[model samples]
Target chain A: MPSEAQAAPDILSVELARIAQDIDSSFDLLLPVPDDPRRPLVEAMRYAAIGGGKRLRPLLLVATAEMHAVDRDTALRVACAIEAIHVYSLIHDDLPCMDDDDMRHGKPTVHRKFDEATAVLAGDALHAFAFEILSDPMTGGGDPFVRAELIYTLAMASGANGMAGGQMMDMMAESSRFDLPTVTRLQQLKTGALLGAAVEMGAILGRVVPEGRTHLRGFARDVGLAFQIADDLLDAEGDEVAAGKALRKDEAAGKETFLSLLGPQRARAQAEMLVEQAISHLASCGAEADILRALARYVVERDR
Target chain B: MPSEAQAAPDILSVELARIAQDIDSSFDLLLPVPDDPRRPLVEAMRYAAIGGGKRLRPLLLVATAEMHAVDRDTALRVACAIEAIHVYSLIHDDLPCMDDDDMRHGKPTVHRKFDEATAVLAGDALHAFAFEILSDPMTGGGDPFVRAELIYTLAMASGANGMAGGQMMDMMAESSRFDLPTVTRLQQLKTGALLGAAVEMGAILGRVVPEGRTHLRGFARDVGLAFQIADDLLDAEGDEVAAGKALRKDEAAGKETFLSLLGPQRARAQAEMLVEQAISHLASCGAEADILRALARYVVERDR
Candidate 1:
């Protein structure tokens, strides 16, 4: 197994596919539709949660957890929690009142497939489910302290101080002129926060102290910035069929993005530089962290 | 204080007023607006959370926590989390895509006051803040186990299998005819779950074992049902000026409610019976629980 992992040019893809399937199965068991009206809500959650996305957050979590040899199932549960929050945010962001995108994950967005009300409730339900998973009673023999930390970290990453706050800034970016520093801070909270949380949660699950996670934090920060830049590049130039959603909306909305601010070539160069810096943060990490290093490279390289 | 409590004919009123102020103060501190574009998101959260509602859930939580002699501040923090969830749900439920409410707390709903996106984000931020509070580092010097339990209970109560699920059932009631059993189940989930969670969280705080909480569970269940029935009654007959929001919409939407299912006379009698039964479940407790007993009575009696 070690030889194959070392020999594979893209171990990250292998792990990503595996984590995606595992996360989906975990959600399937977590969300069984009742034979009642509430079934539709569960269905909406399942529709948005299962069989979608790059599962990048979950893969990051799982990969980082491996650094400490944490239990696989426990790591998977936490991974699912991270991805659930990510999906929930996407569903809400895609709402007509927000980004108003009609498609996601190569399919109709939850509101488009169901209704706007269902989409709202489904997203809300998924948000609740993230906490529920983190604090599940059968929490894989998880230390209560670690579980609490996982929850707090995820909450801080997703709350007003984090992703949601970034979104508020994103909303304002359209009406207000923003310089590079403002955009940088906005992306840090918006996209970077949850990405940071994924690594932080994995570290917490592995019982790594805050002090011990310094390098991992650096890795996450750089990767998060790189990911956002790649996203802008995709929006500006990537194929819509592969991207699976509307593109150039930020340009149309006149929102300032790295691509618009730096131009395509400079933005791409910056993203590549960030990816290299992210990998360097893991230099002290052993070969076990190769997947995370690959993930950093993948952040700016993936089509979507 | 004991003498005043005994002499007061409406101690529930006193406690309600006290909790409202305390909860607002807690929210005020928990949500300080940052000097950034996200300030509006925090402002929206503060607007919805700071000075609205009866604060009944917080009161119920504090009263139940008092039974176990839990730390007062700790109980208050948990109470704020509960109220935060309640307020977040109300904001989302009042959205133009959902209930399309225009007024709340005798003022414009979050959507009307700010905008749909801000309201959505404020609600999402509050939702994250609830778990953030529960798993807070200071956390009242709380037992990590208890904190985990608190998070688990609240998440379960608010998620798809709980309040959100119940909301789905409610939405279906507008389009499909629901019988008494279906309506009962819906109310149990919709309004009952969070109320039950409030009591359960207080009990968890006091280290009350699940088995030992049977009576409290029973009390919460009865109070939740009676509260919904009373709400239905209010919709049919109470003053909108006092209620602070739209009413009779259930009737307008042709939704099935306890009042619609049982008629006004029968529903009033049923609600009263539930309140009595709710109080009866508290009979085993000492004078410390008198506040809870009064809360049962208040559930059906409150005009708003």
Candidate 2:
């Protein structure tokens, strides 16, 4: 709860590590490996969900919720729900038929660790687990309307018009010629929607309806674009070991990305500009908005 | 609706067709293909969802809803929601990583007709659409608690402990020696869970609490068992063309099924017994429950 301005440079890293751990624990609580034939599926889900990644999405939700005094426990539950969706997408995207990935977060992907069928089922179970967390009376907050709203919001963000939609566009990227605007549209749907949903969900838990979410939306939008530009840069120039996965996949797939279109210099400049714009969107707020501002800075500044 | 007792032997078929049409319409309404690059993904979802299959799950939900006097349009929404889950499961289960089936309901499976990545994204999108239908205020019934409850029920039935869990067990069937009890438990989670959710969702719309669902639960349990047993029988002896998919794969995989364990005679007898028991569970109700009774009989009698 220290003022972010006075905090160390790793304010974002400290918060990221803490939220990732909390979300991991929440996933553990949600995933009870049964003493039956289904144990492997649950284990795969647990493996994919826990002990990995930057946890940026959950951090976004948690940080926004904290700004409005939402209970930490409640915030964590919503955070985990969003993270579950994120994990499921990773597992599916890494499948042999999709990205054919072998490593994630310095470890074998789920399909490589387990079999392909097990990986598919595990991804599916985690997807359902996300909704289970949002709709459950316990951990999902006391308000029925809020719970339903959360379910609806996350569903919209994850459905045909959201994350899955973006993934579809990405899948098509390999075979088609894409320019800057098309790439931007694809990223907006693929990565941007979920990030925006994370921030919007936090505001929702604080009872801030859609009309009052203008500034938060602007903050989420700029940060989301910056995050994607940074990712493209990482793919282009960052070390695979540092990124904890295969890099330069965009070039290999012949997919045009922000870095490929704008070049490294322009892309980095665009990302930094976005970070500044995102922070400016919170100009009216106090130190409570510092965490969000720091996250905007971290989006472009982080190496991986 | 005619009294099931006085109707012809095709009573079940008539109602099944009607409900299938209604559910297809609902899916059409919910899925709006975009003009953007995401169109292929949505098109795949539509092709998988709109045509094909028995639509037995939707029939079960609609029949149960009608028995409780729920609105037909509202009932169809829930029907489509449950059907969406069933269809998504079929799409994923037919993937090369899973069953690797080539055909479903006389048409190429989603993964066969569409590219593998699009199939994966379509199935994922349809999965999200189920919760979207259940959580939306317009089609999700009036009460917020009811909406949340519906989502929780479906989520539980679809998660690791339910359909996906059962799928994990099935994946293991190729390697493990499963006894009759193990197979029963697996089927209960895989197919029984969703069937129970369908009936339970209907009762939920009628404001029937969990404690009041004892008899409905019994009805669903017996029908679900009969349904799976009939499925095993069909896989063992029915025509491949009529079944619209490969047959005898259970035996090919050396997996233990009810038909494999009991032989054709005992398996057929068992399904009939379950059908009668399932019908008996509705004995306390009047003519309104007749459709359910007929559907129960259909489980044992249908050829496909």
Candidate 3:
């Protein structure tokens, strides 16, 4: 396993870029291109879907699937579908009437790059595309049952009660005094649900038994929360240039965050403890879990 | 079969009310009881899902599933799920920033009755609940694969390329001189996808194969379009009391429609032809298809 301090920065960057490229290329291959006049809309969907993000969710899915001995190739289609849904959510979230973010990942948001109308359509197309990919018989071996489960799990995690629900809570908390419990609940839903889903989905596909499933969920939950807290810490400490996103934007927005509720020192300590729990949960999962473990640590340790 | 003119005003109203009640009671029996804090949100979801509109989409699903020889009791869960997703979409559509409707089904919109934030969350929760119902292992034997496929199918129909895409087109056409082709495409996507999915999902659950699936697809396509054209004609010619929506609001909004693009008479004729096509495709399926046939015609021929 590559230690954080010993890993060459340039080599690490190159490898990450390659993984991203692979995910993007795989996604582009899966998008629908019907011969109908809706082709333009489909093309726009592909463009919006294939171009963005660090592919973190897909990587986590692939990694988790591999941990349970599921072939990466079998998991590839699901990984693409996961990213498609993630991208679609971001597109909708960035709409002018939604979060109204002008930029994402240093590029203009979907509604900015495309017109709002196209952005809306593009997002809708991407949403449909994710399901289409999931239901494509080729992806699920003509087993409607497996395809159906995949869709249900993804929808629950991504829809209101999961990620979107988390967002609603966050927006609600903007003006309210949120306690630590409230803040924890919000992040768990918003970020942890999807992350938890990513790993649990892998277990499902990998056919992991009850014990393994419980451990994977535990690891995902602790890591997800710790990672989010670290993100708050990064914003409080990092420069905007290093962060990509606006530094201290949480404070600017007057949002209730871990840092705001728990103070900087305690927040960092909590994150470290959570990371330890995450690693401990992964102890029996072996080397395949190393990348994910490192990634969780990096979540807090990175400047960005 | 209930003939259009022979179906009296009070009888039609009673039929619709009974359908709504059956659907509502079935859903109430299925949903999990959330904790106290979340109960109100769940109630709002049930209210928005059950208390509005004719249960046309659920009828399609249940009828089609029955035609494939599936027990109606077994199909009821899917029927409720379809209606839930449809209702969720309508709630979002009526948001102030979306279609901005103040009334639906002759009553104040969900957003107006509740508040905008509650409406949004209600819609979101309904979307999640639809999948939750489908995914519940005890329901439908917890057929994970079928559950996933149902979810994927509904998401595709409801998301960007299907309903949302169609809606974005409607918004765009408000300012443009959209031709018949554009109008038809929008209608098929916006209104057709979910309707088609409703029918197809029933077919999936019923395990309908061969010519039956193809025939149902054909039947649904035509019926779906007919339903939209009828809606267009109703907006142009029906009364607010009869239509249960803002009559002539489409014209006032300057939105392109089948009636606007093809005159009211031609639009009505087109709807009739589609209904004929729908009925013809169901010919090989036997008398069990009668309910579906009646429902298709009912969509276009009704006063409301």
Candidate 4:
């Protein structure tokens, strides 16, 4: 293991790059080219899932699972499932009826490249495949109960009360004025739930006790908030080219986000505080949590 | 149990009505009124799932499970899970970006009653919840292995290889000319897969051996074809008011269907023959499969 005194950013960048590469390969193996006429659906799914994003969510899952000594392959499978959910959300969110964005990850959106109907079906299929991966004994190392629990947790995180609900809230916020607390709740549901789930899933795979899981959950909660605040800052002031999509979109749409509500200076201060709090939650884990600590800081510091 | 000599039509109607009522109650109990601002998601989900068309898919699952002496409650939960998936597909299928329908089951589609965004989110949440229910030991009964198996099966049935794949194929069909074999393949993937899964799920619940399950598979396959042919007949010749949606839409769009290719007389005869074959597949199943036999007849006869 690298020394704790090592430069955090260097460690984080290397780790992130490694995780992204691993996940890309795994997704390749997981989603193969179809021989059927509906090959376009698989193609769209592969396009949306592969070659994009920071793979932050899966990295968190992997990092936490590693701390618990979970097998790399088992943790990777769960990570891929969570990543699939994230990618599906992106595909649907970019639809004409939703955000209507033309670009994502510096590439054409799935709906832009493939027709609208194909995009919808691809997203839907990806969503279903996530559960398929989690419940299959091969993915979770022959533990039916573990697989079942993972399925339940993932479904809870992705269902009406979770990510989808958050998306609905985000849409509603476009027309309605939301205060800080409401926006915070929205962020928690939309983004935090899945982030928290990543940590909780790690703990589940690790077979951590309830008390241990609570600390990880707390860590994830702060990290999720910090991540969103950073995102808001990016949307408000970050370069569109660097972000790989339109920037200042929330402001353009007159939407209320943490940045709009808190302003730039205050939002920056708040994100820093959240990152510190997030790191504090992992205090009990000692050096094993160095990756998570680095990630908490990276969430607010990254350009993208 | 009813004797084989009983009028098939009466038996089917009664059985269908009973299953519909049971499913409606189960869905009501399953999907409670939410206490959040995102209550609208749940409301849309309930609206789409509760008051709907014939619960044919769930009925098939239940009927097959009953024939194998599976517990009523366990089978009902799986039936509800499948029904949730069916409802979700309908909601997404009727989206403005997809079918753009204004009405379904004599009521406004989810997008019409709620907003387009809510309809999408609701459908997505319903999709997630299907796996949630199947993977929960309490719902699929106390066996973790059973729950995992159910989740795996349901995911396969719903994902790219199944319903979503079929939807993509159907969309492609609108822009391309499909011969009879191609249309049959499309119908098989688009509709037959899930219908077949309903029977397969029941077999899984019954713990039927692979050889025994093959017979049921054959039964579901024929019934699925017969059901689609009846749908085509209804779309071509049935009253719009009776069908609760547009009629002759395939013809108006120049879409190839069983009726369009085979003609009304040939399509009707074909449906009748398929239904007979469907019932004949269950001949070894004895009096326990009377409900299924009635359902095969009902597939070609139902007006709506």
Instruction: Give the best candidate by lDDT.
Output: 1
What lDDT does candidate 1 reach at residue A86?
96
lDDT of 4 by residue, A1-304 (tens): 4675464547788899999999999999999987867889999999999999999999999999999999988999999999999999999999888888999999999999998888888999999989888977797678887888888889989987789888878887888899999899899999999998999888889888767687898899999999999999888778888889877788778789999899899999999999999898887788889999999999999898
Cα lDDT computed for each candidate against the true fold: 0.92, 0.90, 0.75, 0.88
Clashing pairs in 1: none
Estimate the TM-score for candidate 4.
0.95
lDDT of 1 at A267: 97
- Report per-candidate DockQ: 0.89, 0.90, 0.42, 0.80
Better of 1 and 2 by lDDT: 1
What TM-score do all the candidates reach, one by one?
A: 0.97, 0.97, 0.88, 0.95
Provide the TM-score of chain B versus the true chain B for each model in turn.
0.97, 0.96, 0.91, 0.95
| Model 1: chain B TM-score relative to the native chain B | 0.97
Model 3: per-residue Cα lDDT at residue B117: 57
Where does candidate 3 stray beyond 4 Å? A1-15, A32-48, A115-121, A140-148, B1-15, B29-44, B113-121, B139-145, B159-161, B253-255
Point out where model 1 deviates above 4 Å.
A1-9, B1-9
Q: Could you tell me the lDDT of residue B192 within candidate 4?
A: 93
A18 Cα displacement, candidate 4 (Å):
1.2
Name the lDDT value of residue B280 in candidate 1.
Answer: 90
Worst 10 residues of 2 chain A by lDDT: A1-10
lDDT per residue, candidate 2, A150-268, as tens digits?
A: 88989999988889999999988898988999999899889999999999999999888889899999999999999999999988889888888998899999998999899999999
